[model samples]
Target: MSRTPEAPSAPPVDGARTTDSTGPDLAAPARRSRLVAVDAARGLALIGMIAVHILPVYDPETFEPTLQWTLFGGRAAALFALLAGLSLAFSSGGRTPHRGRALTATRAGLVVRALLIASAGLAINQVMPSPAPALGILVYYGAFFLLAVPLLGLRRRTLAGGVVVFAVLGPVLVHVLGPVLPEAAAVNPTVGSVLADPGAALAQVLLTGTYPAVPYLSYLCAGLVLGRTDLHDVAVRVRITLVGTVLALGAWFAYWVLVLQAGGYAQLTQHTPWLSEDQINEILVWGPSRDLPTSTWWWLLTSGPHSNTPVTLIMDLGTGLAVLGLFLLVARPNWLWTTLGAMGGRTLTLYSAHLLALAMTVHYDRPALWFAVHVAVAAAFAVLWQRWCGQGPLERGITAAVRGTRRLVLGAPSRTAASPRS
Candidate 1:
């Protein structure tokens, strides 16, 4: 979701009373500043995603999943979405939000940012070498931005309430209506698909794709609320961890009690002839099998990747929040955190490069080696690049375009350079 980190195009920062709870002094002039913890969290999520992509999750011999897959899988992308929301909050206004012309300029910047990210994602989809369509999150990220535009002005409390409602109801509504909606595009969306059947493409992006925007919006909204808080406050970080732990563990516990222990899976096994026992077992191990079967409503209780189920969304949200909280707590000016944050700050560029690398690699037989190589290369490039250039290439380009658009619309130059928020 932080695929395209877009900053506000130099909105006028009024000298309003700064709230200690919100951390930063918004009254200060706009400069290229970022929360290191947020970037570190994004970097960690990016690493997890790369591991999911390159490393073999399940053992070929034992058919048992690797620890990396078990830990990251859906959670990594969830973190990305959450961080994206946080970035949006900072860019829009941080604690003290913008009003009138400033708000309009911010909105225009977001629109431009979304268009750039979505276009890039579609272009990347064309060349991705994965046999199965890579559910690249870049396009979905654009949708997140577009949808979040309206919600930008809401107070933190309102955004928080929206998160609760969407987490519980969003996936449920998607499940109830998904069958009747237009069929989703295959694998990755393409420009041709967008041009030929715009309606279907919209449906896929909103309701039926791998990362359905409708349900995933909860993560974004929650991150927005968190961003409004003083991320620099130790108390705030602790609260985030506590709240996230509760949501995650509670969701998983409910799923276990209501589904497995309550005989939901058993009933599904007995009643569904289409899926064999082994197939069900595989789903339990791997996931809810991408887009889960529609034969039974019990699937809605599943907490699997791409299930788009209520529990899955809620659980992953918790996981993301917790990870972010931990990162914030540990985001000292240490070498380790700094190194990871460097990579995180440039996730858009690194993520694209990783996909390109995947497209070129013919053999994944030695997945661990490949994973190591990718991580090393990405980390090295990020560190070295940051030494010479503050921002990543793609990230800089996107930021420049958005800033230029903002300047044109607002009839003035922005006050700062591109602020990269992963």
Candidate 2:
């Protein structure tokens, strides 16, 4: 879910030092130069995700969507995935993608990292089981990383093209393939289930289940494009902000015009005769059930949270870019932002811990108190650990593994490689 920083001079992918050692010097002060904005954005995403997991999604009496659901429901995961792409880009080569053996080694390292994260997720699924407190994102992350391995060397323009392609086609694939494929058996898939019916598991992670990887490729490619840019430039940051705002507003406006002003809503109700008007409205507000009813193409026009349609993907992508751009504009050495940055830098540890804790407890009885406790403990732990140690425990272990894989594949570097600026 996250990695630690390296010196701004030359950060490697996954925070692996490509110098005489395989890790960073925890005592070094230069680590501050790593992008605080990126980390802060990641921290905010973590907070949003935690809130979504703990808070009530709808008001019991009003039957209206809760503020947390409105704000963070689908967007937090989008932001996290987008950041993951940025991390991949930063690690692989940033503005200049790696080639030859370097690229090969980078891909190898990524594969190892993906497997580790996915393995952890599968193991976690064993304990949490179906109807778990949270549908963990780690396993799907592995798929994302592996899918990205092939695209690591693409230029910024090409990656931007990739974003467009995936945004349109990925969801289309899901809509077409979802009904025919076997339905997913578990909400949180375990190793046993995956092994027993790999096809169904694959279908679930790729297209049917929550946070399907195929449609989500848009976010990853968008992040790749962002990472390939001069993020330090004020003009670039401003463009990101403007572009994001326009894209988000434009997508929403289009959805409204087509679905509401036009006949798209009428078509949805007509096609799904079993669902009442209230159920249709619920789908519009809270997202679809299992998968959006494929009875009508009109469903694609809706842009609700987790809808996984082109409209929803584009809107969420825009929202993610806006958040990242704003943070880039405002990030500083101040306490508030830096505290967030610290937490963001160790989300791999923090997020996993949160999931495990949720699995062990019944927080629904006192959701607000549990949410507060989760946030407080995560923030305090992150700040203190970041001050005392360089990388998170899980991040450190992953970094070491990735570095070893790189070393095995490419041998030692002749000179010290610079850290990436992610």
Candidate 3:
């Protein structure tokens, strides 16, 4: 049987982006693993992202299930970042020996695509500068792509160690260096408002999420490790899910106990009812923290958790099991599956369109109506575009661009390229 062409998949740069390499033990790819999880995860993330962006349609103050994401806590960007990390590992073909030239080219392609994703994100940013800035996960994911490529073939243990060290040190790294580095502090509202004075706006984008790359990348590496290792055992999957769930709850509770329920916390909560929500989210992400450095991000990222809130302690059980469920669901509901994938596949275009839609709201002062319209139009576009164009405009362009570049760089002129890497 002849094989048709595959679209070239680019490792998503900061989908929410990073890096370098120095250490190594050999590693290999798994003989049996299902990529459907990453795809399904990405598909799920895209759906949540749409919902998150559509929040203005409803009341921002309301925390409802449909609008609240369980995975990465509804952080569309984090989901993309985790997906990128997993895809990066999957693409490593972990078994193959690293070739400097070929890997360099692939890394280059990742860098280019990361920038494209970031650029798309920044384009979205032109509309919103602060609280709702369009650039979030894509910004980080794009940066991480460059940061992670060198370690692509590293052993699981080695990468895991890297994740741990970084997670432990990243906050102090962010705080100490934050004052001097305007970009790193951009994500911090107080600092951002201060820095937005005049010259800092352009420089702040890169700094939005600095040292925290460790926590952010942890999710990716976790996904990568899961993919690279033998995770198919029924028990192993359950164990991993259990670990994630426990960590998530511990993180949430720790924050609740240490911070919110704390005497000072109650005072602040009294002043602002929303403070609890914000702190709950922070506690959920960074886990329990004295304040800064010790913050063990509850879930590698709040966005993932925020966007896809797991209703139970073992919410990841839902994420892990959702894959099998989606497969089964798709088998029974092909159209729905295709629709989800189509939205994910065209994320770049949809991402940009989302910005335009958001801007429309801000500009017209009908932000509420615009938000709802954005959701309807974007979801409809995903369904219609897949049916009509088969791929989104920007998605198609990126696919062609990556494939052609791969041909030139890899020296394999296969008529078809691999599918687009998210």
Candidate 4:
């Protein structure tokens, strides 16, 4: 979600570094360096998302999901959400965090940015001509930002604790509350839906929609916690890698024990006699048949991708963290890593462009080729743009708008603070 560091930096609190805003500081050095590991992780996520959009999930010959789908799928989006939270932390004052007037300014900036993202998402949904709609994440991103506003001020420990609470409680809450909520149309929501059926749209975004904010907030909070940590430290990265892997693998093992081998599937079969093994495999690999199955509580047991169930949430969050840690571990001074990190830096531009490309009819004919083309174009453009322009077009535009808005909202006095608006 964050293009570049704009938030004011401060000393670390208990070894955790403080964060900065997304907009650039005019007085700051022109050749600003970014956190390579984080950017590389983000780049990896963006590519995975592109694969999800462009490549076939299932192989034509085998009717089984390709490695791309199995590897990326929900994990990519989870990484994106996690990175968004990290960006939020940076924007809010990093480890130290902002207080009083600075806090107010951060909140205002986030709100405005959320509005812009949501608006763009709606507009894209309306205009993009995909034969089958793409599940636009921009709207969900906007909601996540809005939801994160209130949680921005907390310390590292508190935020980490929140991750635990959200991981367990958020899914339970969704399971209990989601069914009663009004279901919106299955199609991607447009701006027209906001005007014509505001309630349904709101409900969908908050509860039932793809990438619903309620459950996905767990990833965001986890990333926020990670952001507060001393990401630059090798020990920290190692610890994160170990812990995240354990959590991820542990979740999978739990699911295997409780669902696959524990008669949960049998319970479902007893209830829905028409269910097939292929369908079950699809749920296992792709996600749940729907968001979840209401017929049996056993659905809550599996850690399938995008199930939005407790087990799956934990698994995805762990996998995301593990992937992030691995990226950080491998992120070093190299041409490949540098290029990938550059690509990650311009995610706003590349992601939006990728979506637009998907809407085009020509690209649909040969998705693998199109996927490769988009990646090359995005990577090349990112490297060149980072060298020449210093920021992607959309990144620059949004940061400028946010800076202007922050300045207006906070007035002249706030601008003179230790951290001036970029």
Predicted model with the maximum TM-score: 2
Lowest-lDDT window of 10 residues in candidate 4? 1-10
Could you say which candidate leads in lDDT? 2
Q: Write the per-residue lDDT of candidate 4 for residues 1-422, one digit (tens) a residue.
A: 00111111111122232336875443222112226767778888888887777778878898887888788878887888888888887777766778988888888988988888787788777876634336778877788889988988887788787787777777776678778877776456778777888898898887777677877788878877886776666788889888889988998999888878888778867765666877766777777644665666777776667777778778877888898888777777478877877888788778777777767766667888988998899999989998998877877777777788888877886446868768
Determine the backbone clash count of candidate 1.
0
Q: What is the C-alpha RMSD of each candidate to the true structure, in Å?
A: 5.6, 6.0, 10.9, 5.9
TM-score of each: 0.88, 0.91, 0.64, 0.88
Candidate 3 residue 5 Cα shift, in angstroms, is 29
Better of 3 and 4 by lDDT: 4
The weakest ten consecutive residues by lDDT in model 2 span: 1-10
Tens digits of per-residue lDDT, candidate 3, 1-422, equal 00000112323211100122764322211111233334444555655555555443223466433334333333344446545655665555433424666666666666676666655545544455554533344444455555676667677787777655544454334434445654333442223343454234333433224213434555556556654554334556556555654654664565456454654344434544544656655544423222222123222223223222222112332243334333322332246555555565666677666655544446345544755665566668877976787767887776566656665777864555555445
Residues 75-156 of candidate 2: C-alpha lDDT, one tens digit per residue = 8888888888888888887777789999999999999998998888888778883467787888888888888888898888
lDDT of 1: 0.76
**Candidates sorted on lDDT, descending:** 2, 1, 4, 3
Cα TM-score of candidate 4: 0.88
